[model samples]
Target: MTHLFSKLSLYNSARYPANAARPLLEIHVLQPRQVFTLAAATALAPVAIDLYLPSSVGMARELGVDAGAAGLAVSVFLFGLAAGQLVIGPLSDRVGRRPTILGGLACFILAAGVASQANSLPVLLTARLFQALGACSVLLSSRAMVSDRLDPPSAARLFSMLSLIGGAAPVLAPIIGALLAELGGWRACFFFMAVFGFTVLTAATVLLPESRSAETSAAARSESPVEAYLTLLKNREFQLYLIAGGANGAAFFTYLGNSASVFQDVYGVSPFAFSIMVALNAGALVWANQINRRLLKQHSLLAVLRMSGRNAGLLAAAFALMALSGVTALPLLLGLVFLMVGSVAPVQANTLASVMGIGRARAGSAGALLGAAIFALGALASSIAGYFYDHTARPLTLVTAVFLAITSLALG
Candidate 1:
């Protein structure tokens, strides 16, 4: 039987003269198809997470639920996403990446359909949970696939790009969802997501080459799953990265959970305008990623961590100060939010990779745990943010600042 995880020849994306030794500054090496598949697969989760943001208010209105109650749908979805990874990661270890991903995609599509037709808040929230459960496969498999095939340096570069692509969805999803909502209402947004999921599912069947082997997976399966997890948990570095990544994940969820209220209710911005703010914030992430790539050429991953940690701490302080100053103006809040997330976003990929670099077999489980911790904490943050959602920016900014500060301390 063929082993799909076997390393392929390095496909160099750059060429230089024999004497040229400087690292290439640009990332044109990932083939068009590789980029597309990775982007689609990895980006699906963020898209699922954010695509409903703009529709949250509409869904609440249509379902006759309060905004806080409707926000439970988002929280439930994230809860499912976090829970799904715990099982899916190990299952992928047993089955293979391709089967895991395909199965998850199928489930996600079904959930989307259910969500589109949901008649009540309970039904919608339930469907969103299932939707999140299915979407986890897409993210886990993509990261696992990269780990299986790419060398460390190449893996870092590709994963950075993957993070960038993943970030783009949140950057644009609110706008996209808002546009759909404006045209045909909240249900129409689900229809759009369903179409996107279906398209990706079809593409995966045709385009995604299998990257893990059944025989190896089967052999590994012979070991006790408990032992496997315990072994990974024993790794000290993995703990560090997990905590670091989880901190940022917490911060991100804080943003997601509070952005709508902060923008519309606190600052009196329109939904369209709020989406623009999200775009700007996400755009900062993209810029940070670019900077991260450049720093890779000159600094070790640890060096990057130190920088990111400090920056996160500084921004968190800024958030706290901003919240206390009673400056709920859109421009002031936007600038602060952008600064806080901008530096934190790019460092996340490196944080995960540093801790999980032992070998490929553990990547899925590790990434899953990392993701689970982040999102689980994020869900907690979301709940807290929502609970404290007075018509002020203080709750949101205070949460962001606190998370960043805590993360910095932990990472430091």
Candidate 2:
């Protein structure tokens, strides 16, 4: 596995000699505007997924769907995310990043409009699927673009910083979603998605530079899709990171998909208050990712990942215990949730850098594969949690704990 990554490093060094990297880094690495583009691109899918969460119950009622059926909308969106990455990843490798992203942005804008006008559950879910598809394209391309310009160490730092910057969306999304739902109704959330999509499209068209080099593009074109994925799949260590990342994603998304329900329905918190609690947890993610960036200066990526994974697993177990104990302590529950959420960036950022570094030859495909693993597993976890909801925190906490336990095993 190390040899595979080493060969890629050597491949990069030959084409972009170390001396060239400084200038390239100056331009493509975390520059202020580029940071915004990348952050927004990465955050789009999450924002789309989360922005309407506060309205899930309302949307269900309006559409005449059961709670479980409404919950399946999120799971379906996750599935679309996974599928889109698999399709567009290889396409981006062939077509270049800029155009692929632009095309996807158009799709997102169109889908968001469609979702806004949805008259039924099936219509809403279908529109959400296309929305996920577009969001996944932008996401995989942003990830691949970083790998295109930087090696693993630099990429790790950039990813952490990027997450910190983009972390703003997660913090604000629910609050904004709640406010929009209150003022204009549930459809307003989807309307906002369209407007936001258009804004990003314009920014990306004007500001985002093409990072995929001609040499890399040719190399990508030379391989068939089957060969490319086979190259990635055959690496043992990559498989470990995939499992670790996927498990971490599962735990986080399960908690994400259901926490609003638990906090609001069980505990009787208002939508605005629930959003504030989510914001605090999101702030923990930003803080923790910055800490991860600092720790990487001294520790190996694998080391930081293992430690975070262990801590997250413990915190998740505690979450389950608290739920089972029937303790209604909001502050204590949110504290554990904050800690559990904090672990996400370190584990995911490191794991992503590792896998992308290993398959840097076809970075677009590599990123897509990792994203697919994360979201596919996320969809599975959300489905299981949704199935056992029981109007309590038990389903969410139990799913989170089980997934994090898997994460610890993979990272350990």
Candidate 3:
């Protein structure tokens, strides 16, 4: 709730630690193919966010529980992701990126295997929690890896590409899950996730180079978890960016958590049809992501933020007005939805680059804290959206509109 913008001046002169440790291999060490592989590894955890969405309804029937409670499993995973990132982010800084990610991937694989075997709702939920914990390494460390090896401008460009892949995965996963479920069953989705995690684990072990520099500055060397957090808390712009980012994430989670019921119970649409809607949003985001890359080349990161933040605000306001006027036609709503989500990747990548750019010596910590905060915000949003599931799309529209308003204010 604190105003992060007020503290912007405090970090204006901040710089990456000149004495920071270096990567074992230079950024120039890897081929383009290897970089893409690493990027894919980093994106898998985000893919997990929506990979299971198409299966939520089927999962409820199989687990003998109501859909809402089964939906809680997704929220639980988010909680784990938030909490795990908090630890892994700081831990990676203390030790190294490789160890933390490898450990997390191992746990993720174990959890997926366990989830695939779960026969009851509670067991399944617990398995998902662990799965999120494991996935955190991939999510958090991937960013840290790039931050460690590349300068801010280069990192921003790389992150844009990473955002593209991460955004695409979630958008496409539902389609995959729906097809697999229609052919196999809900359990098959988890099985596929396990296999995917295994592939990432293998790739990470083979391709991920260590990146903790031995020449880290005094601040980097002396920073404890407490100090890392205290620094972020006291910084105004960081807090503002964090809140905006988290609110945006909550909006996404609102869509994700409630999609099953919204698609099936409300619209009476098949999973495949629902996935097409999701894909449309993702495609819009992909286009937006590419635009951001071009914009970044021509403008400062701040310019991108101002453009995206304002544009998203205007669009979200329009959507809210339409919903308020009871324009509930499916095409109208889907068009609004796609427009709202279009800003997601651009806004997130820019905000993250801005926030982490300020804490060059401790980007891992910055990334971890931000990731956790967004997940917490997302869990809260998911819970609220789930509560208002009246077999209508109104709940999603209302929640997303609220988040957009909050983000607009925060960004301003």
Whole-model lDDT values for every prediction? 0.75, 0.83, 0.75
Rank ordering of all candidates by TM-score, starting from the highest: 2, 3, 1
Q: In model 3, which residue pairs have backbone atoms overlapping below 3 Å?
A: 4-236, 4-237, 4-240, 19-215, 21-213, 21-214, 22-213
Tens-place lDDT per residue, model 1, 143-196, is: 777766554555666677667766778788878988888898889888888898
In terms of lDDT, which candidate is strongest?
2
Q: Candidate 1 regions off by >4 Å? A: 1-30, 213-219
TM, every model: 0.90, 0.92, 0.91
lDDT of 2 by residue, 41-114 (tens): 88898789778877777788899976556677788889999999889988888888888889889999999999
Candidate 3 lDDT, 281-354, residue by residue in tens: 77877788778878887998777777767876886687678757766687777777777777777778877776
Q: Count the backbone clashes (under 3 Å) in each candidate.
A: 0, 0, 7
Give the higher-lDDT candidate: 1 or 2: 2
- Between candidates 1 and 2, the one scoring higher on TM-score is 2
